[model samples]
Every structure is written in C-alpha cells, then in structure tokens.
Target: MCSGADEKGGEQVAGRAGGMAALPAGLAAAPGNAAEARARYFNSANAFNIHLDPVPAHIFTAPAAAALGPEGAVTGYFLCDQSARLGCPWPATTPFMLARYARIAPGARLAADFAASGSIWYVIAGKGRVYGAGAGAGAGAGAGAGAGAGAGAGAGAGAGAGADAGVAEESALAWSRGDVFYLPAGASMLHADGPDAAVLWLVTDEPLLAYHGLRSARPDDAAVHFKAGDIAAEIERIHRSVPDAGTSGLAVVFSSEAMQARRNLMPALTLSLNTLPPGCAQSPHRHNSAALTLIVAGADCHSRVDGETCAWSDWATLVTPAGAPHSHHNEGPRRADFLIVQDGGLYYEARTMGFEFLGG
Candidate 1:
C-alpha cells in the first residue's frame, strides 16, 4: 500500500490486527456476484490505481499468530475485492491480492500464514530473511506458535524454514535495496530480521491457496533457492543482445523486449522494465492485459488514465486493467525507471475470445 500522499492525510483504520471491520461508510461493497462486480470495479475510473496507506504495525492472532516468530513484526494486508468494487473490469476468472510486511531488529520471525495466485516481494528498504516451502510438506504442519519463553521457535517446522533439524542447515534467501523476488505457485516463504527491515508483498488469491494446500500435504520437502544476484544476472543476460530496450528515454517496444526472458521465470505473466529520459512524454496507449507499474527511480511524472491525471514519484505503485486507455509523461529533469507486470495468459485468452484493442 505505497502512496504518493502523506500518511496522515489518507484514510486510517484501527489497523490489521483489529480483525474484519465493516467497510467505511460510502466505501462500496463487493458486488452480489463476482463477475458483475469485477466488471464494474475494473470499469470505474476511481478504481484505477487505488493505493492503500501503509499500516504501521504487525497484526497477528493466537491461531494465526503461530506463523510468526518472537520478533516484534507486522503482517497486515490490503485486499481488493474484485467482485464488489467498480473500476477496472477485472477478469471474472482471475484472482489478485496485495500485502505489506515489516519486522524490527534483534529477532527473526515468521509473520504470515497466507499465500497468493501470483506473489511478488518488493524490497522498499532495509534487509531481511525469506523462507519458503520444503520439497515436501503439508500446509498445516507447525503453522502457529503460542505465547511463551520458546514461542519464537515453536512453530518452525514442516514445509518452510524451521522445519526439520536440517532446517538450520537450510539457508534463508536474503534481500537488500531495490531487490524483487517472485514466488511461484504453491511456494512457501519466511523472512528473517535485518537492520530496519520492511517489505511490500503483492500476490494473487487462487495461487496462494493452492500453494498452502501443497505445503499442507508435504511438510518436510525442500524448495528451490535463488538470490538477488541471480535475478540481476538474468536481467543482464536478457539485455546483453537488446541494448536498445535499455535506453534511458521513451520506448514502446522496451517492455515487449524485456518480456523475452522475464516470461521464463513467470510463464503465466508478462513483465517489462523501462527507463524514461528526462522531460520525455510517453504517448498514451491501451492494451488487453491487467497491468501494474512500479516507479523505480526519478520523480515528477504525470499519468493519465481515462482522462484522469495523477502525479507519480519513486516507489509509487499504479494499476491499469485491460482495455483501459492510459499514458505517462515524465515531468522531472532526471530519468525515470519503471517496472510493469501484467497478466499474460489473460491477454491471450481475451484475444482468443475476440476482445480486440484499437489504440496503442
């Protein structure tokens, strides 16, 4: 829930640990049916780029609390009910979810028992540890921890880290500044502590539950490991032959080209990393895929979607659904870097079903 606005000016609730509270007055409810609601939510201009302010602390209960370690950490989420909200017409069949993670120093913790259809972790700042599922483990094995002297390591067994004595021998994936980690369907993860640790986790609904189900079935199995250097190497390899897409200016084909390799890690999705030269304007364009853009560098860019304009800065997260007309112009004097993630399969499915795009 990163926003362009300050924390105090935006809406604030009791926070995540408060449990399921009613939607604020005038805040719309999810539609009676998912399909109709998704269509309305995705179609509404207001629904585009809805950003939630960050919650300051972690919220976990007794049963759910078992997943967290002894450290003082926060694990809350920003949920978008596609079936109820009116904005970008989200595909009725697709699912989505987004959440933020935070942890303090001196201790490592397991702060979440959740999963997603498509999950990504964006390191806003600071360092931390991440643990995923073993090759075999049931989701229910050691899912929670009780409040006690040894609660910190109580539920550290089964699929993810803390399982099996060999778990100690198992290393946790470490992340630093400007790093992004992608979790495949059914994978489990845990985060350790670092100096001033914090993270933004975005995920989809269906895949999350599926991964949990797999973990519940096989708790002692091992999982694959990756590092930030590994991701950087892949990016470098992809750009080795296609230097044009790496240019610092307005480029249309930049995204399409980067997808050439990114699609391998995420075969179900399409991704592009773009750089905007100072004072350049990106002509408005529309496509048939649900899209999300994260500002990696620079500042002062104006984004227009369906005639509504908004200012964007570094670390800002924006969303634009299928067939929605939008464009961006860099108003800053410095270059701007942005990352785009889209539903690749959905676009193919729509094209196969006869939905066509007329503008670029």
Candidate 2:
C-alpha cells in the first residue's frame, strides 16, 4: 500500500473481489493525503504520448494587405498569427517561428526590440534606412538616439543617402524595395522610413525562445545586408552555372561570413531565395523543418502542400507545415520568385532534418 492510501483495505478488497474496469488514481492523491497531493501518475501505455493541435498549412493574405496597402497613415504591425490553432500562449505563425508585416509611415521610425535570437527582413515596398546597434548596445540604441547618431539624422535621404552619408553610414543600411537584411539577437534596430511609406516582411525565432523560457543573450555577429541587385545577380549566376537536371531548384541561400560554415542565416533559421522558370514545377519533397515563405514575384503560380493547392498572391505569406509533401509550380510564361525562411538550422544541428524527395 502507498503511504497516502489509508483506504487501501477497501481497494484491496475490491481488487480481490473482481477485476477493475479502469486503472486507479495515484494512491498519493487520495482525498486526505496532503504530503503527496500534487503527485500524478500514468502507465507505460500513455505516459509519453501526447497529441496537440497541428500547425495548419495556411496562407496569410490579410496581414500582407494591411502592410502593403497605400491607405494606412499610422505605423503598425500586422501579425500572421495562428497561436490559437497551435495551442501556444504567444503569437506564432508556425510552432517555431513568428512572422509579421510592418508598415512604417513616412518619416516615422519603428523600434525593433523583440525578444528573439535573430530576425530576417525583406523590403516589400518603398525605401528606408535601418540602423542596427551591435549586440549589447542596450536601450539607447533601440530608442533611436545613441546608435542612430551615425546613421544620418533623418529618413528623407532614401537611396541617395547611402553614397554620401559618410562614415556614419557604416552603422546603417540604406534599403529600397526588394532588399533583404538580417539582424542578430540581443540588439535592436531603428527603421526610419524615407519620404514615402515602407512595408516590410519580418520573421523571427521568438516563439522558440518563449517555449524554452529563455531570453537571447548578446550575439557574436553583426547585421548583414543583401542588396536586391546582388541577390538577383547571384541567382542568375546559379542559373547559368548549374544544369537544370543537376539541381533540385534554382535557388540561392543567404549566408554571412561567420555563418558560412553552417550556410544558414542564423543559428536556428535558414533563408533562401527560390525561383521556378516558366512552365516548370519543382520536385515534390519533404523536410522536418516548417517553412514560412514570402511570395516575391509570381503570377499563375501555386504550391502543392500535402495535396492541398495553395495559390500565390502578390506580397502574401504562406505557411508550410513540417513533414508535408510540397512543391512549387509556375504555369505562367514569366518566372516566379519566392523567399523562404525555415527552422532547418536547428534540424541540421540536431542531425534530424530527414529531408527526402517524394516521387510523383
């Protein structure tokens, strides 16, 4: 008999009389037993098994419209959140990632002070400048005072500001439409929109950190910027160099000097610019990491995710659940381009990526 079960005699008598239909509750959880009242028990058949709600493969169009629409006056963010379906307390687009669209009004500044290990940003429309204080710059940098002191004084400079902004420009990255950049954790950035309003798509690992009850520490690397023209050139180079039959897709992965070894954008995330030529489709495949993709440029394009067709809309964000068979298709005469961010870095580090192609 367990210490808390004073009524074990009755249970014993019942057990001796006939077989019980169900397993009994923990003996320590008896009505009057205070010492082990909190104890809970489960058998081998059910102890390690759990069934939580699955992350839905969905498209986020409304949030994209709110940010890219020309009517908004105030600066704000529209989150592609599915936390309710995911059974998570914090906002999330996927179980491990959170995605959002940021609209910055003309001359306004957006302070990015997220509690995330890292963030990736794509300039959807308009022009602007981003001033990122290196890791551990503290509150002053985030508030647009100390760190931005070197990043020119105002947002009106736009693209012209990059050439003449002087040494102070080194601390800032001037961006226009189609540019992309990454910011490290434990740091903050002040996004100052130029003369016109700007829309940006951003994704971060905040949900992963929240799940582990951990905060990001000082990052070792600084921010890295990717010019739209440079990225396009690289993709063109890949297209010219690799034979169509030799590759899975015409894609280019974004990486920095420090992260070259792992070929990822951050410790937990990977960013790639994928393209599909006219009237072509990618091979169906699956991986362990879920993908959050931004439709950069495509018409008459769609993705087949686990047999469900997800159509592409301009500036829309799409969610691809982990381990789902998926492929991209372009039925139009023009080429299609998309930017994908995934939790593949974590999977690669854990040696559980489990990537494979599914034959049609």
Each candidate: RMSD? 15.8, 7.1
Tens digits of per-residue lDDT for model 1 on 1-360? 342233776643333423123223232365677665555223222344457432111111232222223444433332322322323233211233232223323334443443333345555555665544432233323323311111122233211335322334334456665666654434444444554534343434333244244322333323333344664565556545454642333322221222344332243455455666688777566666655666667678867766667567545556565556677788888877666666654445455422333335
* Model 2 score (lDDT): 0.77
Provide the clashing-pair count of each candidate structure.
Answer: 50, 0
Per residue, candidate 2 scores C-alpha lDDT tens digits across 1-360 of 542233745355334624332444445735566657767666543554568899899999998877767654556667899999999988889988998887777766665656687789999888876665452223224323221111211233122222212324455678888888887764344455656788889899888988998877864667788999999899989888856553668899999898999999889999999999999999999999999999999999999998899999998999999999999999999999999999999999999999898878
Compare the candidates by lDDT and give the number of the best one.
Answer: 2
Candidate 1 segments whose C-alpha is farther than 4 A from its true place = 1-75, 78-84, 87-108, 112-115, 134-166, 187-189, 205-264, 349-360
| lDDT, residue 258, candidate 2 | 85
Candidate 1 lDDT score at position 185: 38
- Write down the TM-score for model 1: 0.54
Candidate 2: clashing pairs of residues: none
CA lDDT of each prediction against the hidden true structure: 0.44, 0.77
Question: How many clashing pairs in candidate 2?
Answer: 0
